[model samples]
Target: MRAGWTWLAAPELWPGRRTAGEVVLALVLGIMAAGSEELLGGEGPRLAVVGIAAVVLSLLRRRMPGTVLAVTAALTPLLSGFAPLLMLVGWSAGRRIVGAGRALAMFSVAFVLFAGVTLQDSWSQQAPMTRLLLTTLYFLATTVVPGLASRYWTQRRTLLHALQERNAQLLWERELVAGQARLRERQRIAQDMHDSLGHQLALISVHTGALEVDPELTPRQREAVGVLRGASVTAMHELREVVGILRDGVEAPAPVDDSGLVGRGTAGIVGLVESARTAGNTVELRSAGEERPLAAAADHAAYRIVQEALTNAYKHAPGASISVELRYEPDSFVVEIVSAAAPAPAPGEVVSGGQGLTGLRERARLVGGMVHAGPADGGGFRVAGVLPYGVVEAAPFVAAEDDFRQQSPKAATVNGLPPMDWTVSARELAGGKERSRAGGIAMGCGIGVALVLVLVVAGGFALAFLVGSMSQGMIDPGEYESVKIGSGEDVVRDRLPNGDTITLMGLDGKGPKEPEGSECLVLMSSDVGDSFETEPVFRFCFKGGKLIEKKSYEVSR
Candidate 1:
């Protein structure tokens, strides 16, 4: 019982189960169609046959939808009992057929066939032109319109799914970026500690070693100095190991300034600018307001921001002039670097990991600061940072990264990177383009359907009016009487008009019952006119290639 319930609850849990469900649905629809036909006075046996055929065709609709649609249309007039099945095939065709051109061709073929069959069956019935028009409209409404609508619905669902998947992928990538940013920040911290604390330990080791060899020191004093030297060396080794763990097995480069004062504070800026100039890059430094002391973390963050900006300028802009500005406001310190744009670099001239700006932003965030980097007003790049004088308690790294991700895109940088003008990946751009294309296709389909509907309605009305004005199928009273009973079918047809006009009046089916096992033809009289209050019609029954009965009747307009 549990297994049965599981299968019922989720039929698609196993292969072929969904197809089985579809087949069951088709069977139910077929049964309904057959029952409906019987209720509407159709022959039970014939309707059952049609229903079975409809079921078979519906099952193949997915694979050969266009072919199935055409076949169903051809059978429509003969099997009016299976109209529901016809509509199902049409809708399936619209959904399965790819591309607008192919769909249009398939629908057009089906529509024409349906219209032709309907006209052939009803041409001799009362008000044939009007009936034809109404039937055509009904066919479009039930079959064509539903099909087009189904196609549109399917497209919308597919586009929505693509957008959802793309959004999910972007969210995953954002989390990955945040993780990478946190790791890089930790490595930066490790490098800073190694430069400063490792240098001090080395100095201590050197001094203790010197004291151990001093001739003036007593034996106990020399022994104490030897122990201190050994401890300092061990501490240095441990520091290296910790730094290695932080850097994830990557070795940190030696500091440029051997004294370890290059990225300490404002003093470091002076040396950094001089070094850039020495490296054949034009550089200028400006300072404003009263110089004040800053928290250790903030000071280091400030120096690093300047160093990264200057390095980027030198690498990317090559010959462009760079300006580093410092403002020591009462509440905060601001550091801004602007570099003019230069000629494009030669192939392979510059290789960048694209992580420098991200690292700067992370460094600033740890010290309660924000960094903004983007294009400047006059064809250049600018990186500006605002740091608090007093260090604030740092937020969790993941939380801080999340805050950056939620920042407005209008800002100069997002998630520690520059604006997306140049940073947007090709894959992201392609996704955007795909969404736009999908929207355009959906709009075009809607417009095309509306246009087709309008054209069909207008044309159908015009044709009905033209057909009503003609009298090509009307017979005079004398010709109707000349068609005697027992006449050969050919002789009777030759005596009658070229065409029949049962469209002058409506049929009630209350006339004399048709002869058993015989075919009948109904025609209009020539006395009928547009202004007539009543119409005269002639009915002829034929059996075994001979006319068996002839009758005349009158119907109110």
Candidate 2:
């Protein structure tokens, strides 16, 4: 019972401001229909009753569109004045009904009822065959054609909305994938730093500690050694804090062996060059400008950039001569590595993941710098990086995690690890494409349906006009003049044409009043052509079986 009440109180069915507006429109239409009926010598009150009843039923059209359409169609033939209400309900039914089969069934029932009533009325009045055909065409134009148009329009709007929503969802998913990729990259960088830099600092602390206890060391020198040991330990501690920030809550995996290629700043680069020379590689290191201390991140980034470039040179151009240059500008530090032309690698001799250069760029960017790498002037590759002197703090892991949670709560992992795959799902792409295709089909179908409806209505009106013109009742002026005012009804009837032009033309009340206590007959003048201009009409009134009055007048066609 509660559910039933809720259903009844739905906004579409319940009376509110919209209902009030509908009522006002209905009342105005009813008054106009009633006035037309009274002018045409019909019962105005009867037409007004039909109009009011149809409007009342129409109020539920949104909730019970099929029922409303049926009721309105059944009432249409009682008075043609209610036909507009029937058309409105038909359109509402089309928009609200979900499936084509259901709509077809509902509209078919309405058409049958409307046609039956119209045919019955015409048969009772002995209407011509053309009148029956025209009535059927009128029913199609007012109800079925308009209903199809409304259905097409509603479907087009719904499809467009669906497509828009799908496009927005796809865009959001793409952004999420990119964010996850960046988070994963940051974790990788933190792991690399922990393995290489932390290891180097620990070694420094061990070496300094051993030197401080040497038997031959002077007191001041030993004190200096102790300070160096303390500084190394502090650097290691700071490196750990930075790694923690980059790692967020996720523990990085154990690091692989780095093959002893670890150091810091200019000292590290010199050691790296010596190691390369000891490995039987042609290598040179040049430095210029006054050396100055670099920010922690920039120092580490510079070391990694050279390490990666040397690794690439060893792998891709095993025998190429490599030159490493370092420049200290006023505001920045520059590292450039160039390898001379070398023969192409033998098949399977060298394998590259292609992430080395990308990592170089990412490292430089994190330190407020940029990297450029491409083929050198001759053949071998070149990699260069510009790193700023001032420290650029790494992004806060806690804030990033919170932002990720806010943007995509479902994407969070209990282990705090980003998912491996950051590419958009194939299914989502397919779904978007399918929606676009459906929208296109719907648009094409709507345009086709509209064109067909226009053609059908235009053809129907043309046919009706041709039939009406041919069936019009017309009499020659000589025959009308020969019939005196006092002639018998049969005599006047024999002189007239066998049709009622006034009824067919719908010009019943647009003329002078008839004589009192008499029956009247109206016909068209034969001399007047059927066109959009004035035409002469003849009216004859009879009393007591004899013609008492006859008159002629002109009315616009």
Candidate 3:
């Protein structure tokens, strides 16, 4: 029961389940339609069929709007009294369809059907001229008005959805920029700490080893120096591990040695392949073309690219065979690393933090390079990067290093050092052009306002004309003029349009009650020149169903 209620509340939960709002609307419309049927003395099975169809159509209005409208229009003539339900269908169509041309077509088809039904019914009771006028008015009321209102709402809804999506996209872009800035800051800190602290630790280890070999020291003192040298060497390795964590925000399978503390240089690629082989993975390295010289930044980026790829293979494919290839061209250096797929992970194996590939991409992008990583052919993954030769000249790095050297000794401390500007420059470089759409917005609003004004003016004039025509239809001026005193009841009814007679006791507010046994019929008519203005009235008294006295005079407002 709970699941049923949940499905009813959310139509999106499952297909074909009616929403609470739709069920309520359908129920209300069905009941009102049944009332219309009974009012028209439609108590048979035909009315039942129409009522059932209307309810079912209303329930499916959002899903199949055009089909429901077409079926409703076809049934309108036989069930003309069910006009309210049909108008609701027209409203739904207006709100759902987007284009004005399509909406107009739908309204036109419904109008034609409604006019046919109205004309057939009025034909027997009304004159040829009167039937046409009534059919047009009924058509406007049943189809045009409701559909136009729905179209207006549909336009507003579409605009609102677009604005919301744009706003969300802007928010996402802002967060992405902020996150990139933070990651860059972490990388700069890691670089500075590795340079300063690692140098000091290496100096301490070297001096302690020198003291252990000195003949001037006692035997016990020499033993203490040996312990000190071993501890300092261990501390240096641990510090490199910390730097790697700071660079990528994740524990890596291999510690990064990009700081040059290990003296790998351009030959670092060989050591990386050896390390991968040592980690129980089969490794192969291939090189093409002659080796070429590169700037410090480009050299480091190339080395880091190979290092990160090998590290990823170790983490994600532990026992897989790997191939590392480096191609040297006239103006570019390309590296590709491919690894075979490993067995499925064990049940409780440690999961990756997913930052390695992102760091590699950012690293390449900083030096005007690109990296691509994805599944390779035949059940393995491939990581590749292309670094343009001479992309980062020595000038920028040399200038930054010179400025750092100029700072005071105390200011070299990481906490005391000024914030770097290279990051800010990189951010500005990555930010693309931004353009404003104000001109288009202004033009769109102007066009929208003009259309609304046109519709309003047109609707106003149409309503005025229809009201004027219908009012004029009620009282025929020619018939009123033809009625004479002493005319019989049949003559009076024949002169009038609907056989409606208003009994009056006066003419121009001055006469006796019932016209002294000759009942007086007062007929009023509106001036056709203006919609709100009324014209003069005529009174004719009848005796024994025959008119006896007649008078004509204007009635004041």
Considering every candidate listed, which one attains the maximal TM-score? 2
Q: What TM-score, to 2 decimals, does candidate 1 have?
A: 0.44
Lowest summed-lDDT stretch of 10 residues in model 1?
A: 418-427
Q: Rank the candidates by lDDT, best first.
A: 1, 2, 3
What would the per-residue lDDT of candidate 1 be over residues 342-432, giving only the tens digit for each residue? 7666346687889989988888877878899999998989999988888675533236456544433333333454432323442343345
Per-model RMSD to reference: 14.0, 12.1, 22.2
Residues 1-557 of candidate 2 have per-residue lDDT tens digits of: 74653453354454577556766766765665565556666775676665566556655677788988887787677666666676677777888887999999999898888777767645433235656666567677777877887897788677756754565565567657776887788789989999999889999999999999998999888877876786687578668866886878443332222444335554578766766665557999999889888876678789878888988888878777899999998978899999987665634658889898898877777677888999999688898888887775542212455333233323322234433232344223334456767866886577557756765876777676765764457677787798898989888877776564325354344679988898777777768655657778887888999999988887775
Candidate 2 residues lying further than 4 Å off, grouped into runs, are 1-48, 124-129, 168-189, 212-231, 249-460, 467-557
Query: Sorted on TM-score, highest at the top, how do the candidates line up?
Result: 2, 1, 3
Q: Model 3: how far is 368 from its true place, Å?
A: 39
Report residue 239 deviation for candidate 1 (angstroms). 3.5
Q: Local error of candidate 1 at 502, Å?
A: 9.6
What is residue 554's positional error in candidate 3, in angstroms?
Answer: 26
In model 1, which runs have C-alpha deviations exceeding 4 angstroms? Answer: 1-17, 40-45, 125-127, 161-203, 213-215, 218-231, 246-557
Q: Rate the local accuracy (lDDT) of all candidates.
A: 0.74, 0.71, 0.65
Candidate 1 has an lDDT of 0.74
- Using all chains and alpha carbons, the TM-scores for the candidates as numbered come to 0.44, 0.49, 0.41
